[model samples]
Target chain A: MALREDQILRYSRQILLREVGGRGQQKLLDAPVTVDGASDVLDVAAAYLAASGTPLFDRTTHGGFLAGTSLESFAPDAVAVTPAKGWLGSFATAPTIDVSLFRLAVSNGGLIGVPGGMPWPGELEGQGSSDSVTLGALAALVVQRFVLGLESSLVKVRNVDGRWQRE
Target chain B: MPHAVIDITSQVCPMTWVRVKLKLESLDTGDTLEVLLKGDEPLRNLPRNAADDGHVVKSLDTLGDGTSKLVLEVRHG
Candidate 1:
């Protein structure tokens, strides 16, 4: 379907991007992305995806700080669904590395990340103080890149000092 | 070449370009799009942006109703 006037206005900022014009914006809206992870990661990823007009499905049980919040509250075009049977992309996050889950995400062409600077196979060093927000936003961008047919690679995000670096 | 008409007189800056870009995406190379737009920002930027995107600006005319009409040709890779 062609973009409605409201959609054109709503996504105008991203639509102006050379990598994300009207066609790319429409692809984002048409894509249903599933989320799973720690609450902080889920919070940031869901917010970014919803604001970008990507239909979101919540698979997280942690809830955390965003338990009561609705993804649709983020934007006019934001939509949230439960038990989504199919999706174009998946994002998973956690404070510790889960080898099985990581392999699954990479194999399925999905994005998965651990909070930057967190030690492997262990709990987050400071939990709420970690940079899950930045990691989550990067994961959401990975989904956006995939949707727009941009070149994206599976990489880890690590916080070096105060900077979040992708490796 | 096919011709299409769109009126973006109610839109501003990026949305104006967004609407025109979407229309252009639906056409073939050499297809013409006529856009009726109002406002200085879109008048100044739309044609420049369209041309930068590889579409040709055939003509731009100001109507008596204080609106400008821009003619663009589609280009796709």
Candidate 2:
């Protein structure tokens, strides 16, 4: 199917990128990407992908907090999410995210572990508001570029220290 | 000799170019498309952007109303 008028307007900013011309945009629309994580973590990622016209299937923990979960509300019907609970291996049947988050797992006011240790480091204890915002956006970035068939190494975002760090 | 035609006379900018660009991408190299749009803005921008993307804009003509017709040729990389 052709891109409709509203679709064009909705995605013009992304479409304008040289890497994401008409064909690349269509690739996003065609690819079905499932973000597997807690609702809190996947919130921003879900919104970003959906906003860009990427078909999003959201997977969250069975009892994980959802709805009013994200710091902000994403557009209605923008996300087609399925709340589920199982081993991370369940996501293996589908494309396990090829990207990694090399964020600091702050332990005792310092960093620990190698980059890409886990999507969500347990050391976070209670996720701060800023953590949610940063993680959400980072998840979206990983999913969007993957949809466009672009390759990126471990992405280092602002760490628990609120400082940019890479490994 | 466009392979397809899309009418965006009721739509606005960026969408005009986006719809045209998508239609062009769906075609084979050397295939062409004809777009129907409204107002002078699309008329001014459509052909120019199509050319900038390395596609050919064969012709643009007024429909004697607020509408305009643009002809574009696909040139895929």
Candidate 3:
């Protein structure tokens, strides 16, 4: 989706952060995100997360399954089952305790598409130790670059003996 | 670090990765290239392709608005 002007302004806040600044923002505006899944929900959720700050999520079963399942199900189940109130108790407690569980369950059979997964410290660290706002600005800059058409130029070169020549 | 920045926005598919490969070849080992691009296809594909070509993707970040960027460190083959 195309970004609006207000988004640019709002995201400018992220750009202003020392870690991001204009250069980092430009870098973000130019980055790419790959979403692999059958459903668009994961894609949307990913979009939301990317906008929020952290980016990168495998929309596949393996990746999403862990986020949607383990976090949404197992964690909650372990907590609910501690009281031994049975399946009904687990169900009753599930919605109240963690809204993400209910949201994931109602949205799909499994937690195929839920937002706010584990933050990728590696990627964030790459952006430097900026605050969430700065990170968000960096993300905004990335989106801007994406819309602006900032891509590498490819020119094929042929090899003559050992040296290379552009084709 | 003497990083080279390539703005490959609007470009698509093989072209995006191809240009990146070309730029890396011009640099010596341990050089860094900051590639900027758009589109989901390239965002997902280029990093893997870079790795296959022996470049290390130091980081890949996507803006909330849908744009993306990748920082690749070049290692001589």
Candidate 4:
């Protein structure tokens, strides 16, 4: 599909990057990225990724505490974020592209703090009032992680000749 | 069989469907794609959309809190 005008403008910043030039941009538009998570988490990520010109397949449903469970269900080629439980027993396997995790707690009336350990940026201490904004921020953070390569973490366990090796 | 998984937590409409469609296209004929969605709009629309697109919806499991996981098997000839 040809790039739309708004798409070109919205993703201009990304397109300008050496790694994500016109070809990359085209790939993004053509390729689909699936997301599974809580409605708020997936919505935010999908909106940002889509607006930024990446075709998205958002599979976020209404319940479930962690988004990773949702991702595990869809089984996309790559996942941006997953729930905590999904990370278990699969630490050694990394997505071909990237995966992200957005963490948030509903407190006072705002989302705050983007902890370094989590993929989603920290909530803003008390910024949970507007769920939409919170979702948007989380989505933006996921995108940032994707761009910065912060989302891709390869957990390695040493094995010598198929045997466990001590570090 | 090739399987694709997506995590769509904390997200809302349009985006949910958009992501699903993209994943569907990536699969080869006879492959299956599963989607975990957690919103009302998406829960209502994703399966319908997938069916409309000619994919076979294998299953849709709904949880108590209103979240759902949909399994779609690509059926391109």
True-vs-predicted CA distance for residue A70, candidate 3, Å:
64
Give the best candidate by TM-score.
1
Candidate achieving the largest lDDT: 1
Task: Mark the regions of model 3 whose C-alpha exceeds 4 Å error after superposition.
Answer: A1-167
Of 2 and 4, the candidate ahead on DockQ is 2
- How high a TM-score does candidate 3 get? 0.31
- How do the residues A43-158 of candidate 3 rate in per-residue lDDT, one tens digit apiece? 33334334533233343443221243322332332121121123222332321111132224324422211122322324544555433322233333333333334432222323
Give the alpha carbon lDDT tens digit for every residue of B1-77 in model 2.
56899998987877777667777777888887889999888888888888888888888888888888888888877
First chain of candidate 2, TM-score: 0.60
Q: What is the lDDT of residue A148 in candidate 2?
A: 73
Stretch of 10 with least lDDT, candidate 4 chain A: A75-84
- What are the per-residue Cα lDDT tens digits for candidate 2 across A50-157? 667665544454422223334225655444322222323354464444222312232223332222533543334335546555555566666666667666445443
lDDT of each: 0.66, 0.61, 0.46, 0.52
The order of the candidates by TM-score, greatest first, is 1, 2, 4, 3
Clash count (model 2, backbone only) = 0
| DockQ, every prediction | 0.70, 0.51, 0.02, 0.02
- Alpha-carbon TM-score of each model against the true structure: 0.71, 0.65, 0.31, 0.34
Off by over 4 Å in 1: A60-73, A80-130, A155-157
| Per-residue C-alpha lDDT of model 4 across residues A20-91, encoded as one tens digit per residue | 544456655544454554455555555555554444443344232223443344323223322223423343
Docking class of 2: medium
